[model samples]
Target chain A: MSATIHRLDNRPQPSLEPMVQLVAQDMNLVNAVILDRMQSEIPLIPELAGHLIAGGGKRMRPMLTLASAKLLGYPGNRHHRLAAAVEFIHTATLLHDDVVDGSDLRRGKRTANLIWGNPASVLVGDFLFSRSFELMVEDGSLKVLKILSSASAIIAEGEVNQLTAARRLDIGEQRYLDIIGAKTAALFAAACRIAAVVAERPEAEEAALDAYGRNLGIAFQLVDDAIDYVSDADTMGKDAGDDFREGKMTLPVILAFARGSEEDRRFWQAAIHGHRTSDADFAQAVSLIRGARAVEDTLARARHYGQRAIDALGLFAGGKAKDAMIEAVEFAIGRAY
Target chain B: MSATIHRLDNRPQPSLEPMVQLVAQDMNLVNAVILDRMQSEIPLIPELAGHLIAGGGKRMRPMLTLASAKLLGYPGNRHHRLAAAVEFIHTATLLHDDVVDGSDLRRGKRTANLIWGNPASVLVGDFLFSRSFELMVEDGSLKVLKILSSASAIIAEGEVNQLTAARRLDIGEQRYLDIIGAKTAALFAAACRIAAVVAERPEAEEAALDAYGRNLGIAFQLVDDAIDYVSDADTMGKDAGDDFREGKMTLPVILAFARGSEEDRRFWQAAIHGHRTSDADFAQAVSLIRGARAVEDTLARARHYGQRAIDALGLFAGGKAKDAMIEAVEFAIGRAY
Candidate 1:
């Protein structure tokens, strides 16, 4: 059977508002640091960076860092900077991804590449990436630096692997999973693990939090990929079918392509390889994906990962932080619902 | 008054061979480490990275790191990785720069962007950048991370500033210096300073080496800028008058525009702003720049910086590293002669 759907009249299921509320104070500090670090004498650096940084998102990754630090009863302000660094890394990747994907919109607004052009976007993204490292250095923890830096390397590898695999319909589910793991989950894992490192928590605690974030990240991306087929620009904060147009090999596409008939396979190949996608083509692709139960399968996979994310937190004592973390996973999977 | 101009019959002056010889063994280890760290499961990463890594520019930046470490009498292998990290940062910037500049050629060959396309180049550049940080993390020194990371950020700022200043004829000498200082010298300064830190030397020694590298870097870039106007693609390893065609505000152009006749100023404005340039126009521009003695004046400024670089070495004890470093400075200026 398909996983339990948690839609409340097809609206965004119980939002990430609670988790965000729990970390609001720490997030304010993180936001302040982000703004301060983004400042530059070059107006374009700040102007282009501010365009993306100020755009609205859940700030989920940084929140995970702050909440994880709080869960372990940390007694310092170091996590604030680490959280900010996490946010900067995320923002930097988003900026560069827009350029890589040739995207025109992000967070329901014009992409930075669209506004400032690719050169500025690329350079500003570099600035943000470097600034993130500076934040990690200011915290003066080599362990934190190791985790974050390795994650950054893995993220780039994942992005490259994805680029290499794009439009290649032969890629299996495992490779797709690997792509998302490196591209999305690695950062999340590092962000949470760093929280434990800064708090001087034991190895087991660090591993647990890392596992939580990693699974959560995978689930988040699975749902995200699923939503790309089902949601619109308003709900997803970007044009729906962007992945299809870009020929990204997400879960639903992989599943649909695998399960398709000969004629259906030809359609995917024509649209993906030949770049012959149009409005009618996207509609037909979506119908084929739904007929293959690909969206349902993708959500099932997301729920499986989301359950693991919650289970990873079982060792932690139950509290607002723990409870909110679990709820955040639910919120993530609920997006697919 | 114009300082020594050791042209050696219009050839590149005394090469950086001595410095490379001094750090030969250490560079071997650095090369090994760079090759090791550049490896990834994704074959494209190593392929593209290896293409540039093996493309045979003198490993001058990494050599500086190794030489600095040796000069300070350090007795450790940590600098091997740090040097590799330095080179990765430099290479990553070059890869990204090629994309940003839409360059077709580098070091007498087609650029990676030309071969792999912009998307792969951008992502691979990111992979290399992240790999550099991973190397720094492996070095396990927060101070080294701080210095290198800050340099990276400043370099991005410098690059963005240069992009902004491109084609702006009114930009003065100080801003031009600021651009090169950030873009070039900052990394050189950091690469040298890290040696002192790793050696646990006093702050004075660190500051001295930093000053030395910074000045050398500025001089090297100034000479490079001047060479772009006077040298051919064969000598410079890239196209001549590239900066002029791209409207980059190098010192020779800045000096020429500042000192030009009214009609000459308008010519520069039309060529730079209006993009009204041709082969004949380039010949005319060269004559105008030479008539203004801007290339000579630019060489004069490079000599000034080279002198400061040599002066910064006075406090250090006499050794092969020091001698090679001085010779390297002479070689940098010699390029312009």
Candidate 2:
């Protein structure tokens, strides 16, 4: 492998800027489509949607679509629209998640719900979702529609599963993986696999890209869960220990609950299940989590997934597009530090 | 035409039982598909969805699909699945609408939100919507996908438009129609048109069914608005004066505001716009609506649309299916009484 090719052992994490720049031209088109589709005569629809869409994120999902298409040597513009649809699905989930989570801040800014209220947030989220389907239909590919639509259903089911499992101390590691896999990885898998379908690539290549994106997504969310326990508000883009406060059963918490002593487990039950918590409780919980080595173990799991993600790209040849994708996987896991 | 055939001039409104009887077997298939699709490993999904689906509002939109197909002499089984999909979309919208409207009761039963809470309601609504799209994909026609997806977007836009227009007395009759056309009529139109599409009928036939459904939906909504003004809590299946309490500018209030005296308009401004109201205020508002002939005028308008709906069915031959459809339109308008 060349110096630029990202490997599993690489300690220095690559910056997301290069991966973003790799598909900067396609990203611009995706942005345009997002803006165009989000417009509505109902001003609230555009106002609420634009607030989040225009708020800066890495646009990582769409970038995956664009990069996967580029790696396959597909020279078509339809992926631009599909990428936009992918982003819409992501944004719609975020909007609804904020409501479901009762979250006030996202990306260090007041959430749309805090500004526009939950009803508007929910309705606008529905509008954006519907708009995503419109874009997909305009693309006129049943295969593409099936993939994205099924991904949407899986995401909702994941969210529902998470809701049902909330605050349950017995939520196992495998169930946690299933939740994030459906909630996060399914969209990523669809976004990447769609590029292959649109390029008229074979099913084998599509399956490979799907595997890559799915593993990368699990790694990304694993790191995010880890960061919630360790990072400051500024680094994590929201309040630290939010998962604990909200009583979420993320992987780290699951590990901590599994490994902790009876007394420590009692503390978790009172804090999370009872929801009678304080800053000191949070501090103690964090101490217990780190003491139990849960955070370290979570990151280790993320690294494993990240490695698997890079391995999933074995079918693609060594090139700039492939390197950036592999490097993007590194960056996803690297978010832990 | 036989006496059984419903004509526009007919004064006696036909019952919906015959229409239900006509599509009885097909509706059973649709219901089975609904129950099948609603199943999930997560127990909460089926529990909540089943509660509402079995709560029993007439499956009017899906019936339009089945009836339209039958009228065209199309004996395919695809319409049953499509009909189920249509009902899912409608049920999904109701689930979301209950959340958006903060409704406590629907169809004489506690709403899903009241039983499960807003988060569950919103997420399950999303699941149903995604399932609807999946059904469309299984139908394997890009044209059907395009029509249904576009209608989904329009329905959402109409809802947002209604949200924006809520409590704004200045919203005119045309804007009101536009809102309902999108929120209500668009789905009906798509449902009816898809029947023709699945049957491989010509474009003209599709357009005719679309028109029939669009007009019928408008008339149905108009009667609903009128019912909101005149009915008791038991009759309306919700609290009487709910629209007034929510400050909704439905047709009766709109017409009343247009024709009422200056002092009467001021009462509306305080009660609806200013949100300063009481039982006495609602009672007075109802008296004023009756005196202004708004209820009468609204029912007249519904009748006009009902006539147009029957007219749109003129392209169909005289038959039980066509007669049932025409009667369905009359039943829609007759609800105002």
Candidate 3:
């Protein structure tokens, strides 16, 4: 649900390369549209926005848009603008997410809020958000606008929900899942769903793509949360135990807290409440999470969603596009290993 | 260019009451939609949003929508939701503006950012923005969506432009006009223009309403800036000299700086560069501004736009609605006295 970078460097495993290759041509057009539309007469708008937009994070959401268009076998260029719009929306949310979290780092780089100040970040985020709508409006599709706009509202609502839920262990798994669904998965679902709208495909096909993207998004986020505990900044491009320092109740904490012994539970309560923040506390926390096998189960749960994401494509005719899409889900799940 | 309450308690001059009375019944529906929609299961969103939404500022933008609909004699209820959408956009901008300015007070009340903090303000602003788009999509007019969305983008761009131009004396009246045109007048133009769209009026009428709004919006903002030097917090519900304290390059400051003596210029430069922020400095600023008649001339400039705003309605039939709209413009300019 947060703005942690999700690319994997784990070699000799399933990879997102297939989907990347499949959508390479379409993504180029989308990138052009993104660069062109993000420009403004106001230089700082582009300067602050480019810091994050041209930042090194993978264009996962837009890739879903392009890849879904391919999976439908609908030959049209309308999705290119829409794909750019998807990226703009994602970038806008990322900017705001950094401000909301008081985050210093994203994708191993200083956040826009840190570099440009929250005021510039907030306003540029607004500029990009509005520009995204301009792109959707230019496409002149009410259906596409509805899908993306609704996802945007849901994303904001989910962010607020997560904000209120922060540091509260009692929020439980269902509430946490709901938060991720809205914040992370809604845009993914919308990104894929709009391709069908642009391609003039049927609702069933749209729903199928939505399912594929939504489940994949969840799997991706679950892996991302799991990685925060195990990977140092050198490997994952994110500091280890960041979520723990922030007292984020990712599934690892949720499971460990639920399954921990009484003394361990006491430690977790202090940790989530932010009393435990030192190296020893984090090490102890990692040991507790390992003892409870929370990280393993979180990945196991991600696989459950990853399988659903793959199977959601079952109705689509098998082809290179479909194979790449399936392997993308596998790659998302495989990242945890 | 910043969020300040605009309602006038000054009793003897031209008034917005006629237009308020003209749109009173319709405003009930707009207000209803506003209350119903600002709500979310996330209590903080509604709680924080309601602080600003229910805050005592006049419903100036939505009132323009309703009155413009009356000016065109449009008989439909779609505008109620659309007007609410316009207000949502306005409110969203206000929320973000407060965050950007680090403002503690708005409409004489503590700002939502002050009450709930900046993160809540930023996210709730986002939610409201997305909700505005959803409302437009529900109305299903691509034209209205385009106008509003384009205006939205321009507003954000204008805000960024203003941010960059802040405290910089080089941004002359032309640049200042451009800034207010985007940050202040663009939505006002959109609010009125959309009424014409819903009325199914011709392009000429839409353009006329847009001009009426754009000019009146500029006039309103100019007077608002003027009043920053004249008004006291107790009477105007805004802190006097806020613009002075923030080193805001408002119209009065621009005019005074342009016309001041060499010594006055240094004081003005020092003031704008954050070297002077005490109440005595503000008193000196007001004195120098009065010395150059900058506030008077700023009001005169507002009258120029206000006259154009009233004259823009020349083609419409003479009636209470048109009279009310013209009186609203006069009310805006008259508030400066």
Question: Per-residue alpha-carbon lDDT of model 3 for A240-260, expressed as tens digits?
Answer: 888899888899999999999
Candidate 1 lDDT over A269-308, as tens digits, reads 9888856578899999999999999999999999889888
Q: Is candidate 1 or candidate 3 better by DockQ?
A: 1
In terms of lDDT, model 3 sits at 0.90
| CA-based DockQ, model 3 | 0.82
Best by DockQ: 1
Q: State how far residue B136 of model 2 sits from its true place (Å).
A: 0.5
lDDT of 2 by residue, B1-337 (tens): 4544345537575688778988898889988998999898888999999999987888999988988888998978999888988998999899989988999989888999999999999999899999999999998988998899889889999998998898898999999999999999999999999999999989999999999999989989988888887887798788778888889889899888999999999988877774656777888989999999999999898888888888888777888998788778877877766
Pairs that clash in candidate 2: none
Q: Which ten residues in a row are the worst by lDDT in model 2 chain B?
A: B1-10
Q: Pick the candidate with the highest TM-score.
A: 2
Candidate 1 iRMSD in angstroms: 0.6
- Model 2 over residues A242-286: C-alpha lDDT tens digits? 888889999888989899999988888987775656878888888
Chain A TM-score (model 2):
0.97
